[model samples]
Target: MSYGDHGRPVFSSDPFGTVPPGGGFFTPGPPPGYPPQPPPQSGSVNLFATLSVIFAFICAPAGAVLGHLALSRIKRTGERGRTRALVGITVSYLIIVLAVVALLVWLLRPTHTSASVGSSGRSPTSSSTPVDAALLDGTELTRVLNQPFETNAGSSQRGGVYGLREFGTSDERTEKCVGVLHPAASVTYRDSSMRTFAYQQWSRPTGDYAGAVISVDEAVVAFANPEDAQKLLARATEEWKQCNSQRVLASWGTDGKFDSWTIRDVDTTDSIVTATVGYTDAGSGTIRMPTSRALALKGNNVVDVGVVMFRDPTKSADPETSGIDVARAILDKIA
Candidate 1:
């Protein structure tokens, strides 16, 4: 039996006012009815948490900040994305550390003779040693090729010149025996007028000027003392490291496609340092020819050789090895 608030007996009744044969009365467990239930509400997603993950790759610091904010918002609002936020934060820190380290290395690295590595070997401290008065030795460079070449088209000579202007990057940015070389600066076309006062110039040999899709030239210039050459080459290995992923305008074309150059391999032995460098089209990622370079200090003289060739992707026949062969020849000649 059930009782109402007025202390009256209560009974369940049909809407039509009919009663069952057995019974229609019911008993209530509580005094008042249960409160009505509320409907479920939707939750909001945290946008900061999502940004954290996206920026992690492109901007680490931003990702870290967004990740932390997202985590905080998630905890407070019970949103999702905890895993994404954490991942973004972790990656951001790692990238930021790498960026800092690279900057420090660039700021602290020795820049004194760094430009001469790519530019000219002539340093104010250098004394044009090793250059023989009678040894144009154009054949010395030609003899380096054990295999067939395009053939030497012609030859060139430069007396009292510090470095070979006829070959190499033609940029003074690597190591500057001279202070005016700028590898980052725009490149200019060199001609006969410029050669008169150029920092580097090499005499041409008989066959051809030795132009190709890729070509490396080697030569030696001695210092007044062996110690100077050794001192200059001390940081050659590190210098090559900076050469990786370098961006430059196409020397052959005005099409505005930049080339990304990289140093693939770097090695050092006593006073010698060698590396293989290659380039790719910055836009299409098309790999171009690669060059191998070796610099060695033989007594009071410094020998440099470079091998240049278009890479044959199908085969492993790298022409850069020719640079090493030429270096060996120079050593034998000096020996």
Candidate 2:
């Protein structure tokens, strides 16, 4: 047979030899071996997973180390995650440091205004002289007692002095009965003339014998005695009326739970009388009497006066005694 173009016969067949060009067809194959295709790539690591890592690392120094590890893993695996974790760690540490510094500053702050005493013995904060309890004596007591009873009869300015004393059980229950004094000015209805030198006394019974007295310008004008005590209400009333009327000041008996009397037309020379009469009834027609008074100085411009008295409820009454003497004595000091 004639060969077409190759040395081998064009139509000849050889199992181990190359086939003729137009012989039954077979295609060329790939190179001997190719690495198996990599398994289909999983999608990039989840973004939420990176955020979770950030949260876990926040405020924790170890969080940064963990975040870095995560990032390295992601890079090797071609995954995307862990970037936020690194940022969280740094921010958390910064916040912690700032908070510590703020707390320290607040704790170290101080409060209070500075003050000092001067060489004159006066504090920069105050200059008032403190009251000396030791200085309170009989004269001072009398002056204090008379202060509240002094009254300015018809003057524009009214002033008075008063005094108080504690008596009886000394318990707080009887404390309200403690002595007190009040003095007021007087007025004449016709002339509208004002007068000073009016005074009053308040006394409450705490024990058995109890009463109060009032005086003006060193004179006893009003008094009250407890029922069943030695003193009589009628007598006391008469005495007050006589005293006030003599001064040309009106006085009368008050029909009320507390005995009250008022005087008018008071002047510097004329005494104004006001008083609270207290009474306690002891059985068997006996009565207790305690009296207090207010007085005004005629020559002195100072006019305010007052007095208060307290008595023990449990005590016995001395019928022979009247608070008139005590009242007169108190008023005498003012005169």
Candidate 3:
């Protein structure tokens, strides 16, 4: 090497000066006996191991799968991130175990009867007193109907505290007819002091009932005083008497269809009113078997019950007796 004008050393030949025998300007090379060093191994992380950690919080099953794959790949390929794979696996399994335990607890829980719950599986509002709990659940209604019964879809209203407007209508006859069909439609439901209103429709063989033979309905309305309950009973009884032997077309009422009902008879007493109704649809002919209905007053609650028979009533499940029996059972509960 020699110094340039700027006082910097300039290379005249290879600096190490260990040249080859070819006599060209020689360049240094690896030592004669040593093998060439292989390219440095890249230290990239295992892909599965990284995925395991990321999926641990999003999807437990995916995390567990990815963790097992990561362990296998790490062992075969000697990649990094074994600790991350183990952590993901442990957390995923813990979450899975906890979920299984929660499901088991819910499935094995006991059924409650004393406390009334709506079809939605929620209790009534806080304003509901024990008296408002008179509405029967699936278990009670099943026994009353003498068959397995289930709640009708969207036909449950529990823990309601409404004013008389709930029963108001421009047509007097229509209102009276509705009151006869359902005691909750009476003028007493319009009372300012009206309390909780519980109503639910129940049916047997609740699956594929398009060709059903019979159906049952039950309702209960609670008032603050027994006088109000009695007044409701009286109004319903009078309405039934007026609607007797009359055919009323269902427009916007509960039926919500173009069906007509012919009230055959109305039986009224001091506290109970029973009726027999013949039903027909605009397209379907009149159903031979009549529908039996009864309303009973017990303390501050009025119980309404109905049974419609599309076919002949069986001796074991007579429509005429089922409504009366159900009404008695509900009234006994209230008393």
Candidate 4:
């Protein structure tokens, strides 16, 4: 140690052992009582921070633990991964909260099937009740038709259930009247105990676009009991009363032309409803075409018959078809 011109004490040399012309105290390292620190480390991403983000998708709980540890270490050690640690911690905690919420929702959700059971601990039976196959699909059902259908000239379709609106007029009032002419026109058929249905049609093959001169449609609808059949017939009779003198327009086949019908007369009895409908075939020119339909209920079955008889417009009188004969023949077989 030495004294400068100012009378201040100065070290002869720096701790590094080098001195200038003007003596001054110099420190190449920390002052006394201070421990040496490690070199200022370059900013590096924390291993836990990286793992936290990676495990957030694969294992969220593990990621949250790693993120918390990384952030604690970053704060205490003054490392360079503060941003990485914060991002990991934030993302990891957010995923954990979302997972917990989802689990709670699933655990608390309502069960629909359990609520539908009655106090008897039994589920309610389905509305659709299957019936005997022999009613609508048996050979006896087809044999009831009195019309002489040419060999292999008859085509039939049978099903366990049928919709009334699948065919016929769209207008409700007109459809009510049309239901007598066409069994498939009554939309309420499915509401009853209608178990099985069959539709049979026989047409004389004309082998041309002129269409079949005489075609017959017979539909057989079988129910579970005679009372159900009676109810449907009564309901149909009420609708038929409102359908008098209504014109119905409908399409025929794939042809672009349309056919029309005029309900001339509607008659209803205790168990039968009959109607005379005037049909005009768009392809057959402006001519008077007449059709008759009869619907009757007997026992547990209802039979509907439609007969179209096209006569020469030039002739004053022509042979007419009877729908009553066809309907009675089929209804007789129902019992």
lDDT of each: 0.52, 0.33, 0.65, 0.60
Tens digits of per-residue lDDT for model 3, 1-335: 66669999756466674445754675567989998764443487888888887788889899999999998888776778789899989988888888899988866643223233333455322223354466667688667665566677887766655522143344556655755544344343554355766676766664644423256667777777655565666666777888877766544355445456667568764446888765655466554556678888666676877776655434225545667877887766764
Error of 3 at 243 (Å): 1.2
Better candidate by TM-score, 2 or 4: 4
Tell me the tens digit of each residue's lDDT in model 1 across 1-335: 56769999766565555456676654445456776443232266678878998899989999999999998878766777778889889999999999999988877655434553422354324333334431224354445553333334453334433333422243447322111112111121121111111111232333543433244454555544545555545544455555544433223244444344555556664445666655666687655666666766554555666666656654323544655666666666564
- Weakest 10 consecutive residues of candidate 2 by summed lDDT: 221-230
Query: Per-residue lDDT tens digits of candidate 4, residues 185-260?
Result: 4464857788777666665445532432366677777777655666787787676667667677654345554457
Candidates by TM-score, descending order: 3, 4, 1, 2
lDDT of 3 at 244: 79
- What TM-score should be assigned to candidate 3? 0.51
Comparing candidate 1 with candidate 3, which one achieves the higher TM-score?
A: 3
Cα error, residue 49 of model 4, in Å, equals 77
Which numbered prediction scores highest in TM-score against the true structure? 3
How big is the positional error of residue 172 in model 1, measured in Å on the Cα after superposition? 10
| Model 3 lDDT, full chain set | 0.65
Candidate 2 structure quality by residue, lDDT tens digits, 281-322:
434322223333333221222223333243443442221122
Per-residue error for 148 in candidate 4, Å, reads 4.1
Compared with the true structure, the alpha-carbon lDDT of candidate 4 equals: 0.60
Q: Give the TM-score of candidate 4.
A: 0.47
